[model samples]
Target chain A: MTTTASAPGRPAPVKPGRPLRIRRRMTPRRAGSIALKTLVIGFLLAITVLPLIWLLLGSLKTQTEWLNSPSWALPENFLNFENYQVAWVDGDIGRYILNSALATFPSLALIVVLGVAAGFALEVLVWKGRGGVLLLFLAGIMVPGQMILLPLFSAYFQTHLTGTIWPLILTYTATGLPLTVFMMATYFRAVPREIFEAAAIDGASIYRSFLSIAFPMVRNAVFTVALVQFFFIWNDLLIALTFTSVGDFQTIQVGLLNFTGQFGQVQYGPTFAAICINVVGILVLYLFLNQRVMRGLTAGSVKG
Target chain B: MNNVFGNKRAVLVFVGPALLIYTVIMLVPVLWSLGYTLFTGSVITGFEFSGFDNFAKLFSDPKVGEALLFTLKYAVILTVGQVLVGYALSLLYVFWLRKASSLVRTLVFFPIVLPTVAVSLLFQKMFEVAPQNGIVNEFINFFGLPSVDWFGSPDTAFLVLVIMDIWRSMGFYAVLLYAGLLDIPEEVMESARLDGAGGWTLIRRIVIPMSLPVLLSSIIFSINGTLKVFDSVLALTNGGPGSSTTPLTLLMFRTAFSYGDYGYGSTIALLLTVICLLVTVFIFRSSRRDLTKG
Candidate 1:
């Protein structure tokens, strides 16, 4: 964008200008620097990914091979994928994944819907208590999640939401509400109210205007919120542990945690295979939606 | 002009559902938890008025004090570690790797989405030294060094906890700080370079001062998050090595569930809540001053 500052007449044609001079002077030193940088980056990438790769490879190896050999040892049976089967059947990660999906998807949808509406209300519509309501949510964003656990547990049992996905869903949505509202509100505020006003003058109701104008304007934010909330719910362990305690009802996290205790000592292959089962979904989502995930994760910091 | 947008009912219509759910699930629970601090028993054991009894216990209990001390230590160490590693990674991103680091950044951030339980289990297996050969031990053996019991003692276990945490979330802070670094306009950087500010000096005098707000925010975020940490530690060591790794949250959780002492558990939770709130406010206030100065 700023290349316009150094246009054709500025300095390019005279005495091989500053940029060209720097390039000419940079061959040897730049090569060394580039090599150094690549090394550092490679080291970092290894730290980030080598353990995960080892986890995958280790899972493919049998328990005896995994323990007897060093961590870096390659699996003897690349064709044998029995560990995943064991993790799914014996560890019951399949059930847990199903339970987690049941908990995450519906709540994520509800949060998006509720959050978008609240954002429109506070950020677009002229309401008397907008600041008060916004303040409520801003405060909600800061509320330490664990602090609400005991009372939520109390309510969970009373309402019969415990031992099922309902309590986890409710907890996720509530905990996710503040950020959802805040992010969506920021998106809504950026939207031009004049469009909504024009729609109102055209005999369209405010609800209709929102559906037609403001909602479309804030679709990116809605998607961002959905992705972020899904990540939170799926990654959550505290609420899942407290609320979904039944063996059949546990989410992937709780299931994986319990399964670890049972198998971590001796059954390294299946244990890690179960861990991979849980992570693969998130990893795949991350690969496909890396940019959106980056933007959504960083969005919180910007708004805050 | 009589318009549908002019009505207050629209406000309620838009905001009501979210507020209702948030209030029922979050607001009410917070208040209920506060009230629970004054009671002395559980659902089955019945309740009794225990005025200041839980608070009194919180102070006298040596375990509570020990847990508090550990929580503070953990918060300070982990927060600092995260900030340093993140800052370095951000510098690497902007100054060196540029677009080449995109794949690396994605890989780094991948762990942030993995369940804490899974990562902790991974680390637990990796660091295991006794009874069987885990990865870390395997690595040490490959180098001709004797195996060290990583989690057999309090100090090593706590160190592993700290290292695992930094490994898991360092990417988040790095990416966050990198975004902040990118926000420094290219023009300012070029001018700084032109003015003979090179490398560390430029970063020290220019970037640090410029990105103070984001830096402070990241610090506060890490501190508050670490202060209330439960699941990661629970999954990692379950506050093991003879309660050496036990944080305040774990202590509170066990008190409520394992011991069925709801009142005392709630009291510990309230302490954690107050600490987190105080950190948030303090850092927020401090950042406001710094931000306004810019």
Candidate 2:
């Protein structure tokens, strides 16, 4: 692990003294590195975390206080659960949460099932002219999802799928399958081809090779692809807003926005509180699943 | 076509359901929407075949023109800012702040999972007027300057929307670039340094050139994402202050769903799809040049 200690235009390496590469230069380059690092990291932190912090602080403040105070400053009070209570019962996020779960969980489940089955078949199943099918799969990636909005809406209208969660789930599964299949197919392709050959020579059926051998080898990719698609379907708002306008089927994105106006008041505090909960919940889940998802993303990129 | 030889039958079997569903749900609508370019129609009443009237009408329509211009403006701002900022941040994480990279990466990518509507709502409240305390306005007032209407005005509305988008996507691009940076073999950087190539020379001459594939892909992703920009615009301004923030998707939605001008709306959708596909192909081709050079 060779490290670049210095670049051009900078010289006079300092005596190694204070421990841990602390021997430093006070030149503009050193200062710029420190300043640049500080500014970039601070800007990212402020942009990413501050909104949630502001949301939390706003949740604790009264409507008057929140509206009147500067956004970044904290509320004067502490641990006020009143906003949470109002947000849960009054704003109807309780029901919205259920709606979101209903829409997201099924889509996620379907995406995993379809993605894995397709990935396995593409990888392990012996087939001539599978290249064309793979090209069709890649074409899905090239298509921008919004292009389908009109026809999807029209399709739903004719199929009686409108105003129900089914349409959103179905659209989500379709849109999600492309990238999932793309990522997982390449991933499964990376599994040693000889292993599948050996399994076949042992009189193992194609289904058995996929079920008993290839599946376990690529389980990490499968899990990561599933979780990433889960987040995609979960964070979606356009499809939800477009396909289902019945309000009960609104996912959290549409749900949270509509809640701001629901109870005959602005209710900024509770909306902020609910947002705080949503932020923390998703962050925690992503953190737990981050490693697997990131590996899948990088794996896909390298293959590309 | 013996069963054993053509057992690719099962391959089709496995991939068929997903491809069929995706084609029906996602691809078919795009094709259907493209058909709208040939007709003048309402959503409820069937459309008559007018053949290119919708496209011609699109040129004459001021709102569609404005929305297209705005979408381009937004894409330019977002791609430039996100790429530059993301590259800088990736440099910081890779070369400067390796120890904090994991925590920073997780925190930054956290926003990628956030619902756009929620982000828009956060910004909306933060920029709301009449309170004198909207963070942006407050900052303006604290500087002893008159507070400008941020989203309430056309120029500022587009600017703020662009900023929100940059904030959302910069981290994403940064993480991707960082991964590319990691893929750069350590010996190359050391050798570059041994040759006294540092700072701008090292980055411009080496690091960036090496990461061109990732960079181009990020650019393509940003362009596609910006061209389809909707949820935040919908949640933030709803193309308000007189359609200043309206992008293609919003315009398409309005035409198709809001105004019941299905023909015109589908024309816009087809136009956007073609534009996006062209851009994607262009980026992919350019990146191929970079990859071969590698």
Candidate 3:
């Protein structure tokens, strides 16, 4: 809601024609500031956009053309979809994408469900050893992911869960819990205590209050945490690679690695194509969940 | 009708599933890793419990020693660089460059959202040696500097990994810091200026102290992330050039997957966990007000 107001107190309606008058009376200092801003903005745009252009260009050109063509220039053709087809088929990125979705989706759902409960427990529910419980969750966040890899591998080995996505799915869910709980708890804390108190007076139990009142109020935050967890799980490569065999349950990131073998011959064209696909998928997801994450972060931090 | 259940039990019921899964998968694994540090190799070989033998071996292993040292060096450098560079970029975005922050945020955060494997591939092409059409080497040759054997030489490869990682992550830290900066009231800055505080004085005293929590959190984040680095290293160097840039995680990976020494790998992993715990405890102790008390 602070989006509209630059300052607190009286909200002034924007004066019509003021910007035009301001520009008409602009001093040299203002013009110089504007010019410098434009230059910097352009520089940032190039840095962001150029690599993508290079990736697209490389994807379009054949190996010979890619080596010979100037890196700055675009490819000659726009209709080239050969690389996409090749990446889809030869790279088998299509299957990997499916596997990634299957793994990430369940993990995302579990994070939201469990995270909401955890957030509720810490912030609202009265329990013995509350600080100890919260500390246990925080400890999960502090543990370096590397330290768990071997132990997880050994544990999974004993359980005969090797070469399966279940271990990865479970790990992602657990690893994601601390962050999701943090964000959700921060959000739920901001809801007026009176709302919960009123519900309690009405004989609504804590679970009832949470389910009927708190959860609905923080839907925006839940969406944000879900998006963040989705992105993390989707982009995760380490646990995916470590837990699964090369071809059995490979995700997109691990599948992408198969393009560059030990012989140093790289399938740059399809590899770039696969990267583009994955990036586009992420970008689309982000765009879809844009407002939730951005606003969620702001709300959570400002309160703290 | 609902009086049959109390609040405490309801809370436990609601929280139980998540706590169960997390403890079983995450907490148990940690304890199991710690346990692995005790047994000598495996049970199949009629293993005997050798108390702290693994921990002793860990201290004595030169490779482990080297990896830990290199990881510490890189983590220190990366944390400092990330905070400084990311803070500067955030300041630039918030104050000097408003419109560009919008554009640059997207650009910088773009890499962070991408899979790490793809980032490694992109960097590999950029850092490919000179006279071979790599982007970075092409620029080096253009400047008439001798092309660095990045990714080829032990001396320079670690630097390449560091640079690429920074490029990929600078935006994430920048975004976090930018958000922190944006939270400060403009009136505070104006008042500081009116009070005749110099630019550095205003930033160092007011802006920085206000954002200390975010800054500290960013440092902790960068340290943790750098310590567990695997995907980028695996894809880029695979701990090559005689293990010059092999971090602790990469070393642990080689121990388990490459060598099938699960017991030893778990030992390395446990030691790393202990180090991380110590560092995290230290950070928490120093910044408890910001992280926990707040």
Candidate 4:
């Protein structure tokens, strides 16, 4: 095993069954190692994050500058706020944002409310045939949304729910439900029996115990489910693309695709600006809820 | 306490909303699509009970064959690329990246949140032609290689889709596998290390085996997800340069929506669903076999 005292840029070799504990004293070799790791990971991070940064910078460039200059070249005017204005006005991005929010928030709220309720029931309440019902929802996890797209579209058309935000909302809620319920169930089930039993002795109803005790016990799961559902609905293009016919009802993703499909080459500035804002909005949200999102995504693999 | 906790009405109240929504929105649609396949019609012409006619047509459709082959190829490419890159990055995280891994993981996973259209647009900008050649092409030209039209050909367009899909998703796999790796008890790792296990030997014998379930889960996940891929490819290429990159989902969407061939599209959708289900079951069975044997 290589020791940090001897080898620069090598991670401290562990013995076994122990977390990688950071060394306190920095020898010259350790310092160099730290610097090198920093540089390498910094480079990797740069590769990952810089494209979006470049896209933001590119958004600021005039159409000619964007087409003419090296992608890295600083824009002629740093304060090209007009490009964002154009993206908002000409590209119809604000409406797309509004549509995305309309589609996403309702779905997110429904996913949480329903997910928490179902999770509590399956985990806390003694219900008959819970396993069978759970296996049913588990099967939903295997379903590809494409399989349902046509029939759902037909059903929506039959019911006259097409071309509106409601179809989008309903589908998002439905598709998001299985995983939300699954993830929430896992989290709620992990809460100790003693906690619930204590609440029950106070004569709390299952619903009341869930709200007062189990919900707080699984706040992280709530965050995880909400954040994951947010990304799913926020980034969904297929539902909006296929189900919604009204242009005004299209989500930001569909709107961007349509914008890029038509004006991508000729109107480069506003397109990049639109992409920039879309990326920035999601990136900001991700940053704020980073841990919960990661937990949600990785929740499946970690849980049985 | 037991009385309050397990009251039948309370149970109903707790689980009713999600079960209802899930049934109507999710589960019903699966059965509905299966039902739709039995009838044939256009949105305009109205449906008639056609009785496996759509499936009959699907059997003879060369386009169906092409789309299936393309989807299989696409799924294989994405699943391999995503998992391999993810595994490599996971190794990097545990072995070398260490503290810097957090930021790298964060940076990598950031793409998972972006709108698929946004990612496709950015990458499209990166690969588009001159006078505003994408920076990638520009970099290639910087090395003085002749300009290559990436999306101009079937092969390159497919390659571009694969690469773009990998970029958008590889981070997700890395984080996923990394979490799995961290779950391996350090004693197993250290003992493996102490017993002269290093490099490939350590990862192969210890890390990978310990992480097999997660590995299997990810493979199943990426493959099925890739099989059903639509939004990214739709945004990136729209199955174009002449349907070269069209997956089943895109084909299904176009057939049903664009051509208004509701029956045929439903048929393709059913095929894709079956493919996903088959792949999932096969992987689960194989992983179980591995568990028992290895």
Considering every candidate listed, which one attains the maximal DockQ?
4
C-alpha RMSD of candidate 1:
4.1
Give interface RMSD for all predictions: 1.7, 2.9, 3.4, 1.9
Q: Which candidate should be chosen as best, given TM-score against the real structure?
A: 1
Residue A303, model 4: lDDT of 43
> Sort by lDDT, best first: what order?
1, 4, 2, 3
Better of 3 and 4 by DockQ: 4
What is the model-wide C-alpha lDDT for candidate 3?
Answer: 0.76
Compared with the true structure, all predictions reach lDDT values of: 0.85, 0.78, 0.76, 0.83
- Cα lDDT tens digits for candidate 2, B126-197: 776755456777777888998777877888887788778778877777788898898898888878988999
The DockQ of each candidate is 0.69, 0.54, 0.47, 0.70
Badly placed stretches (over 4 Å) of model 2 are A1-43, A67-73, A263-265, A296-304, B1-6, B285-294
Off by over 4 Å in 3: A1-33, A70-73, A200-207, A262-264, A294-304, B1-6, B42-48, B130-132, B144-146, B284-294
lDDT of 3 by residue, B18-78 (tens): 8888898888888877776687554223445788777788889999999998889888988
- RMSD score of candidate 3 (Å): 6.4
Q: Candidate 1 docking category?
A: medium
Candidate 4 chain B minimal-lDDT segment of 10 residues:
B129-138
Give the candidate order by descending DockQ. 4, 1, 2, 3
Give the alpha carbon lDDT tens digit for every residue of A169-273 in model 4: 899999988888888888877788888888777777666777788888888779877887787788888888877665359888888887865664567788889
Evaluate model 1 with DockQ and give the value. Answer: 0.69
CAPRI grade, predicted model 2: medium
What does candidate 4's lDDT look like per residue over B22-43, in tens digits? Answer: 8988888778788888887775
